[model samples]
Target: MTILDLPAAEAIRFAVPASRWDDAYAAGMSEAELLLYRSNLLGSDLTVTNFGGGNTSAKIMETDPLTGEAVPVLWVKGSGGDIGSMKLDGFATLYQDKLLGLEGHYAGDQDDDKMVGFLPHCTFNLNGRAASIDTPLHSLLPHRHIDHVHPDAIIALAASSNGEAVTREIWGDEIGWLPWKRPGFTLGIMIRDFARANPQAKGAMLAGHGIICWADTAKDCYEQTVRLISQAAEYLNTRLAGQPAFGGAAISPLTGRAAIASSLMPRLRGLMPNADNASRRKVGHFADDAETLEFVCSHDFSRLAALGTSCPDHFLRTKIAPLVLDPARLDDDTYLAQSLEDYRALYAAYYQRCKRANSPAMRDANPVVVLVPGVGRFTFAGDKATARIAGEFYLNAINVMRGAEAIGDYVALDEQEAFDIEYWLLEEAKLQRMPAPRPMVGRIALVTGGAGGIGAATAARMLREGACVMLADRDAAAVEEVRAGFARQFGKDVVRAVACDVTDEAQVSEAFAACSREFGGLDMLVANAGIASSAPIEQTTLELWNRNYDVLAQGYFLTAKHAWPLLKAMKEQGGTSVVFIGSKNAVAAAAGASAYASAKAAANHLARCLALEGAPEGIRVNVVNPDAVIRGSRIWDGDWRRERAASNGIDPGEELEAHYRNRSLLKRDVLPEDIAEAAYWLASDASAKSTGNMINVDAGNVQAFTR
Candidate 1:
């Protein structure tokens, strides 16, 4: 039945996920396909399991390719994959008998690493997929199909002090319970023995962990897992019906909480102490849903948060605990700095108290999660995706805490146990295996006139190197369409669009604010918006002169002015820059283009002034002068092209490009991408030490060359 079919009052509080299995669709599927179907269904709902936090498996008979005889193979979810999104190849296949045979060589807990090394030996047909730590947990069970998942409801019960009694109260003898132990061969054997002894048990709860259940059929195992979680959610909801979550609110949520979070995050990001000079800069995500607000504003927030998260998945993503901020002093920079300093010291002390001789070296001590009372939660990571996922994991942790406290006293994993898991060799190996960070990883940029050819090209190049970009253009619809294309090519997470006229003061301020709100701060600003006017000094009207200066000169001034505070805050983080798209006419006088040339000249001088003013704070400002960039240039689409062609005595249709090419020293045709390459270099670390300089992308125009 659907959740809506439940009694009205119960349905309102129900947090369970209904099964989405379609029997007709599963009718013709093979055993392995059915296993994948079960996994996708289970993982599709967060109430069923979290991202990358669960594994599913099936034991099936397959003909050995060499022997032409049937053999049982174990297929389990591989390491570092999300079950819901994985394809058939995501499963790691091994000889079930060989996987079980490894126990004969297992000495004890000390052989945990050694056992992981042995899994590859059991690979079926030399499948290259690596097995996860939970592979043994799935293989040792007697049933043919098994599901091991960490739903918030199930985790709440597992992490509660009275979990065993509560579990029995709900399910009687159908479910069993086991004491806490680290997941390894020993724990696998414990679960194996427990299942063997309890012949009538459908599933068992691992103390302070999650649940494991099994059945003879894939559908049966999937249904059993969902049923158990649904039951847990119902029981917890009943107990929590009238209970105040986290002992009621200690503070009211602030009005304009989002505005406050947007203001605070960039400063918060800046104040975090770096692990080293080469550490990846962190991006941020802000969450203010009712659940997050309730937990952050609760009377018991400090007490419970200090105890930390019980689930390893949550702990590893969010750190041992979040650093809570005082809502009253959120705007106080001194207070924020001191709080961050204290947190680093405390984290270092924790590592010192728990390190073993073989422990991986201490990591960056900055808190990944930050709690702002009355506002919401902020999570930071080396990229946008991880920052968003870390916030999701913390929200799950909050649900677990809410449920556990409703049932009984909430318990966290012991500190030393937490340390061992955090610094585990296997976990460290996984981190080390990650590909090196992209050149622009963790950088955020804003491009004005972003719907145009050069702006879009520059944005794409930065996104390719892993930077989040905000496209600000006067054409709202055009910029959105360009943004959609970028989102398609390079995930929706790293790109956002804001309709803005760069010449307007208020709009420019809000655009930079939107960048901070979306990705936590600005690392670079591309002052590229412009208007072209082809007129001699006598032919140029006051309106044309003002319009050209408004966009080309004042526009650069406004965007750079708005981006200053963020750039200063990120000074120590490094690579803060401003790249102005100036015209070649700014340096070399061009016939019949006095208004456009003079306005661009003003912008070029402004960059030099900003470069001088910003050098003390490590902010770099440079200019890229592009000449005769006719193809794909928005300015070239209008009368400017005809006016230039007429002045040069050439046809505007096709001869204009040839004439300009022939006049160039190198006879090269400059495209939008040519200008984008120069802008990208200035915006990146490659030009970190070069500023107040101009690069002319005019093929080989000696007249436009820097003096």
Candidate 2:
């Protein structure tokens, strides 16, 4: 049989992480540069460390700005920075001597919360990057260069019931072990004392935490860290041979898991509670890979998940525990709703049981991670990046659990300790210090004709305000180029592209489905795809009339008709919106454009009718009309510009825009950006109460004004 057909336990294997150091690359580098190179290499492997879950430090001599004398400085990864993607500026620099001197101010373990306040006072070189709480853990360690990372294999050993005994069995005197302690001044001191007493030891494992290794040179330190993790992984793999992980699988995975996830995501998102428009809404991500499916379908899944995660990093991201659901009953709405309520109630009780008088108020109690027995996992957070990262963190937890159970019983952290870390006052301050979220932070939008000028501009405005957008256009290459540019400017997680001809009903349906799959649901729809034809009534053939209707009229109908269900599902998220990009010709008649004007008029009326039907459900529909957006419009690059200019007795090449501008009552030029601004307002909550209305962006053309 093929490897894919084997059970997960039988297919499990662990490969040691190899060193990626290059002597030629590190030959002429300074101490700080070597530290960065080492950090990037170690963080490159997930088996070495998860994202933003570790810190590395180097004590180096640098010329003091104040005294012009060389002083020893400690450079470590700053708060909220991921080592995998960090640059030199990402490190927080502090005076090494000043950090060590703080040992005298330590009034004991109770002062851990206050000790963080003094880190800024020890800042070296006026670096503004904030030091993380783990600074003490690295600074107090008696070594010139140190690496502390949360590798899954090492954590599996650290989190097992017999962690100390197993650690001694594997490394003997080379590695030492310490009992569980929250990272702080005391833990650092404990590690320092342990290292001094056992100078022969290279590193120590902090029980239920992670491993640390040290050396005199940067290369030695990096190689030692890699060696210890590789050794632990090899030991685990040997012990796990012929042993079923998590007591073997209880249920086999079902087929078509993606389809199931897509079907359930919208309903799940709708059931979540949102306080108001000011509060950030949740965006969802789904994963159904083989590894995830194996754990979710295991026999011990329910029990182990209840125990929660051991590492502080894992616990903070995945929450105290995940909400588990039965795969068989997934189709039952009552069951799903009740399970969510049960999970929230238990979380509240946990908070009330463990809360101190000064503990931060309970945050949202909804589960960030959810497990389906026969499927995989679903994670939700305030944005796409966070949601996706949270999923990655949980996968690390899964690997830790699998390794721990393969050798011995996996031990979770104490409830009191978990609560203390989760509700730490220092962490609360960091949260409060974060910048306020933008207005469209968790919104998802889909724009038709996104390769064209107006659609692309509207999409950019939405993205700048923090919305995820899906660009659907018939010109696949042009749309992809736009998606790439936006992805670079915003982020890869927030923008996507799909080729679509709006006139085709099947393609339109699939486009909306793709949006739902990429993001949980749609919050806004911009029906902006269009075509133009300018011919006298007698000269307008049946083919021309049909082509105009197929795009401007039928295309809008198909897009809106498909967007209705997803928008209705997301109504609780500050209400949903549909902004139709109409034209001045829709309301004001022009001599030679009978077919184009009439089709646009049909689209305008469609918005009003939709508004009447959707008002009861909190869905708003509106229109934006433009008179002469000739600068970047795709329609103006062809026969339409010449036709209009010929009818108006002007040069089509140079005088077209000016002729249309002077004819307007306001005598001003109308541009694509002007139309985009109107569209943004109509879709945002600023215009929430006003729907079934038309906003004319025609430079004050009296004939086109709404009456």
Judge candidate 1 at residue 125 and give its lDDT.
81
Lowest summed lDDT window (length 10), candidate 2: 1-10
Clash totals, every prediction: 0, 0
Give the winner by TM-score: 1
Which structure among the candidates has the greatest lDDT? Answer: 1
Clashing pairs in 2: none
The TM-scores, one per candidate, come to 0.96, 0.95
lDDT of 2 by residue, 1-707 (tens): 01122364662656689888899999999888998999888888887999888899999999999999999999998998888878899899999999999988998889887888899999998999999988998899869999989998999999998778889999998899999999888888889999999999989999999998899999999998989899999998888788667777777788988778867777677667753333467788889877787788777788999999999989889898988887778878788889988988998899999999999988888889998887898998788898888889898888888888877789998998999999999888988898988888888899999988999999999999998899999999999999999999999999989999999999998898878777777888999999898999999999999999999999999999999988887666667899999999999987889999999999999999999988877889999998889888898999988888888888998688888888898899888888988999988888989899999999888888778
Q: What is candidate 2's local distance difference test score?
A: 0.88
The TM-score that candidate 1 achieves is 0.96
- Candidate 1 residue-wise lDDT, 1-707, digit = tens: 00111111211243877778899999999999999999999888899999888899999998888798999999999998888989989999999999989999898888877898889898988788899988889888868999989999999999999899999999998999998887777788888998889999988899888999999999989998999999999999998886568877666778998788778988988876458435468899998988888787777788998988998888889889899988879889999999999999999999999999999999989998999878899998889999999999999889989889888999998999999999999999999898888899889999999999889888988999999999999999999999999999999999999999988999999898889888999888998988888887898899999999999999999999999999888877875999999988999987788888989999999999999999998899999998888888788889889889888888997799998888899998988899999999999999988999999998888888777
* Candidate 1 CA-lDDT value: 0.89
* Root-mean-square deviation per candidate: 4.2, 2.7
Residue 659 in candidate 1, Cα distance off native in Å: 3.4
For model 1, state the Cα shift of residue 420 in Å. Answer: 0.4
**CA-lDDT, candidates in order:** 0.89, 0.88
